[model samples]
Target: MRPVDFEYTSPTSIEEVVRSLADGGGEATIMGGGQSLMPVLRMRMADPDLLVDLRRVPELKQVREEGDHLVIGAMTTHHTVAHDPLVAAHAGVLGQAAASVGDPQIRYRGTIGGSLAHADPAGDIAPAVLALDGAIEISGPAGARTVPAAEFFHGPFTTALDEGEVVTAVRVPKHTGWGMHYEKFAQVAQSWCIVAVAAAVQVEDGAVARARLGMANMGQTPLRAEAAEAALRGAPLQQGALHDAAARAGEGTSPAVDAAGTAEYRRHLAGVLAGRAVTAAAGVGG
Candidate 1:
């Protein structure tokens, strides 16, 4: 299948890209790595009149630290994230999650912004971002705004970004002393996750101070396991506490039934995997 005929423009600057999209008036699609968009284009599932390529926008490809957060350019590749020493030191959870995104080739080309903007519920980064409490920085005709991870995702393949906005960067807070883990179940090495969980635990005096749980494919979006987080707060960072929290993993999830697994199966796996992730984060089973 071939994509419908479209006009292609490679912009050299973020401002140019924004102008292109603004003029396109919702009929344009930005292509970064196109790991996700290309397939949709080929299948005719999407047929935008304009394809704005961000490849020439080099400013969107940087990774640096700003005060207390690691500011990652949206166009940074998954492979880059996986291998970056700074990412490993401060946000190992993202590094671990990025390494599991796809095979080597895909990782080499897939961009973080592309992955997040694609908004696939089964995408690896969505859950990781949720767990990390990252924020997305967007620029549009009206100027710039920041959208928190919790509010950025609206539903499967959807987001809070305005029509002409470009996602310029993602800000991940440095979690130097926080414990984190990412656990995913997939059919094969390069396949999408069946039920994935990313957990971050902040411990103090042998007790849980803060816990964040992000679950993939449990609903319309990469969902926060709020119940699980609530259950773990102030609890001893032990096996029993982790297990109890895991049991509440899917408390508010309304997962869809599909070939990957039935809702019941996913709900079950959610608890099991959440327990594993939380335990790992807390060093309970290490």
Candidate 2:
């Protein structure tokens, strides 16, 4: 079904968007690349009275580095994120995840900020951002604020974004020289992840100095494998130690039961993929 009739405005400035949203009084929806929202609209899943498009806002389409963080604009497309040299250099895991977001068409139109705001548990970007210790920038009538990726996701399809607030950018700390990989398991190509792992490893003298692991489709939200990350610290760069650390990936988590697989099966895949992700990221022989 087609979306219901709605007022639409393509604002060129954030202030105009914010003011329009305020006037909408909780009946407005921000449109980024619209790759995700259009489907929702057509299905009648959501029907906002006003649609505020951000495409005309040049400020929201940039990719730049500030101090020690890489700030990616909210409207930046997945295709750009996947191929941008700066993203590849500073946040390889995020870039890798962007590359795996969908087929070429979806990647060309989907935006990272839109994906994070949609907050799909199986989405590739959120877990990668969480593993990178990134932050989400927000703007609204109340002014702007930043929320860390860990605190940004509240539940599946839910986030810390208040009504009328738009995600302006995503700030990720630079991780130069770090080994990174995004491991995903899907029923078919371009399908959502059944279970996926985002691994970033820092090695020092043949030992794991630091490790960050985030798993998708294993809980209410994308979750960090704290147990596994803790165990990997100071562990030798060997398959045995890596497997031991990876085995803890499923600890203290409850995944959902769905057509994709059972919760138990998802948990099992988490552990197995954790091992593969960490091994490849840390440069250990598979």
The deviation in Å at residue 97 for candidate 2 is 0.1
| TM-score (C-alpha) between model 2 and the true structure | 0.98
Worst 10 residues of 2 by lDDT: 243-252
Query: Residue 30 deviation, candidate 1, in Å?
Result: 0.3
For candidate 1, give the lDDT of residue 59: 87
Q: lDDT for every model? A: 0.90, 0.93
Q: What residue pairs are clashing in model 2?
A: none
For candidate 1, which ten residues in a row score worst on lDDT?
238-247
In order of appearance, the predictions have TM-scores of 0.96, 0.98
Q: In order, what is each prediction's RMSD in angstroms? A: 1.3, 0.9
Candidate 2 whole-model C-alpha lDDT, 0 to 1: 0.93
Model 2 misplacement above 4 A: none
RMSD of 1: 1.3
